[model samples]
Target: MLLLSGCKVKASVWKWLHIAISCFVTAGGLLLLKHSGVVTGGTAGLALSLSPILNIPFHYLFALLNLPFFVFSYFYMGKSFTFTTIIAIAILTGLSSLDSLLPAFTIPELPGAIIGGAFIGIGLIGLFRNGASLGGATILALYLHRKHGINPGKSNFAFDFIVIASSLFAYSLTNGLISVLSIAVTSTVLALLKRKLATVKPGESRAIHPASVN
Candidate 1:
């Protein structure tokens, strides 16, 4: 049996349930940030920044931007992980699309950044714990951590910072700065949970099969 936080649990329907809940949480957080007119990081942030400029919906852009990353994931992360990641992305994308049906609402920028970041972070933790990711820079971060022992949090933060910097083109300086705060909050939460997430040694199987764990 695989050791998960020193506890043994068989993989079952719980894995799918975890992924679905995590995707829902992440989608809710992204919707909050979207309504606040702030972007965080990765494909989601890029999609947010580009949606208005490109005159496309966020969910559509989100899926399109992730195409290249899926290729990278397939090559580096193995089929099982890649498949699971694709499913996660689809779920998140579907959930994001539902925002159009909800009543229009907006959150204050600062609180949206803080609370949305926390929700995204917690959702990511659940995904990672289940050997899945939301794709984009997250796939690269997890790949690096698994194969080269780089800190996923640091790598993820660096990528996120770049995304946020680029977002300055699409948003006000205040919103850009607030977006940075959101990413920082997310990074902090990931850092706190890093120890509990699994890491693969170099040369070990790079694919983290979710079917092997609960």
Candidate 2:
């Protein structure tokens, strides 16, 4: 009984931590978009675009939009990955709704485009390091990459372009194109950094000097 109880407690704590981390990354990515006045492809972006039309907060809509994908993720993703992802999304939704609490910071258009992309890229890679994801087109990208020998980066980029294209109807072709470039650059950087980080020494997180890995 004691052993069982301890295992359960550990599971609960892990769940909480995973959710917290997911929420942190998701909110961080959202903050980038908020600053840039742009959005990306994925269920979260879909929610933001439709929220005003549906009379809902972007956060709540994002959570709701994820339901079907969560079901797919649960079946398609491994149990551990899916389990944490669900919790991560729940916490993210809660945090996203709290946007009012965060100060609204905008950026100059060009700088915003570049910095916003970098922030989202790094933030996503952080979530990936923790063994989860925001889930959407990337999930589809993963499926294609695994099943068809397609490069994950290329798959995601193509899908993201589709997302960017859709935005043109709502915003403008120019604005839509910029957001696409931003997401592509960011996700590409994330993928590159992820590959480099994976081969480094264990128990060390170093993006700079590995001698600094202490």
Candidate 3:
């Protein structure tokens, strides 16, 4: 049990609640970036870039693109981590679908990039701290960190740069530049929180407990 606001909460319940809230925040960030015609990193950014060219919805593309990574996560990150990641992805995908229900609105590109990146970065921290990820580059980044002592922020940024480069074909030069700024913000957040989100040392069998996130 964990004491949250003077109430004792079961760890499992708290973990699931944290996952749901993180997914909602991440999904909201993606929607903001999508409406602003900007992109960040990870599968979300890739999906945004591909949606128009492929004539598909971003949420559907996001879910579809993450499938392969789940296999990788299962083999390397363990069944528990893979399972949590799947649930988190499903929640995010469900929330992202609500974009079609909301009335059209626009967020300024620069502000959206900063705010949306912050939202995503913060949400991702919650997931990673709980032994889960949003799939794609995040899965690989965490894997490398756990196995090789690599810095997740730096590795994640490298992967994001490649994704951003590919996005050039889908966005104008200005929007592409703005997308870079968005990922920079996200990577910076991750870098700053690196210590907090640090995975277990190589060969450690301990699992990340939600109550230990602080």
Candidate 4:
């Protein structure tokens, strides 16, 4: 088990605790990809895509792009959630930078994609359950799920499709295809986990099936 902020914070403390765990877990996944020279999907992938053309590093692009989502989250998910998400994003951004510090290591693309993608999938589920997110596409997907009753998993998959497609133009086709596979694994995990967390309303719990959404 895990303990954070003692018991005084009560239920709200879980949000912060999960946010911290999710940050490191997600960052670890990205770091694995960095070491192996692979890419995944979603807003992080979009940042990777933009990194070359913008001549900006990936972490900076990722952090900057996610800024707009906080506004959307504030109105839809409420102040507490938006604030927690902001802190989570900042922590994740910082943690991901530590990729440079990892000892020289490398792995084949396929295994790297599977392991790295699994880490991200688990981390994202943790964030979703805790009423926080990694921001960017996640924020939009969660807002749509909470407000309009769209299924977050499916919506997130759609966003990943776009992100992966755009990646083809930025990197080799093979790398982009590997990213698609990685995201497919991530989305499948999200779908299964979403069912476990499903609830009928926002501020209730996570999960909504696409067919169930109105």
Please name the candidate that would achieve the greatest TM-score relative to the true structure: 3
Indicate the residue-level lDDT of 161 in model 1. 94
Better of 1 and 4 by TM-score: 1
Clashing pairs in 3: none
Candidate 3 per-residue lDDT, tens place, 1-214, comes to: 3357334345566667777887888887888798898978889899988988999998899999999998888888888888889888999988998888999989999999988988898888878876778999999988887788788888988999899998787679899889888888888888898877745532222334556546
Expressed as tens digits, the lDDT of each residue in 116-161 for candidate 4 is 8888888888787766788888888777776687766688878988
Model 3 stretches astray by more than 4 angstroms? 1-9, 201-214
Off by over 4 Å in 2: 1-22, 103-105, 144-149, 196-214
Compared with the true structure, all predictions reach lDDT values of 0.83, 0.63, 0.82, 0.75
Candidate 4 colliding pairs: none
The stretch of ten residues in a row with the least summed lDDT in candidate 2 is 197-206
The superposed Cα distance between candidate 2 and the true structure at residue 23, in angstroms, equals 3.8
What is the C-alpha lDDT profile of model 1 across 1-214, one tens digit per residue? 2477333233445667788898999998898898887789999999888988999999999999999998888887877788888889999999998998999888899999999998998888778776789989988888887777777778888999999997797688988889999999988888887876766432122223556545
Predictions ranked by TM-score, top down? 3, 1, 4, 2
- lDDT of predicted model 4: 0.75
Q: Model 1 — which ten-residue stretch has the worst lDDT?
A: 200-209
For candidate 2, the TM-score is 0.75
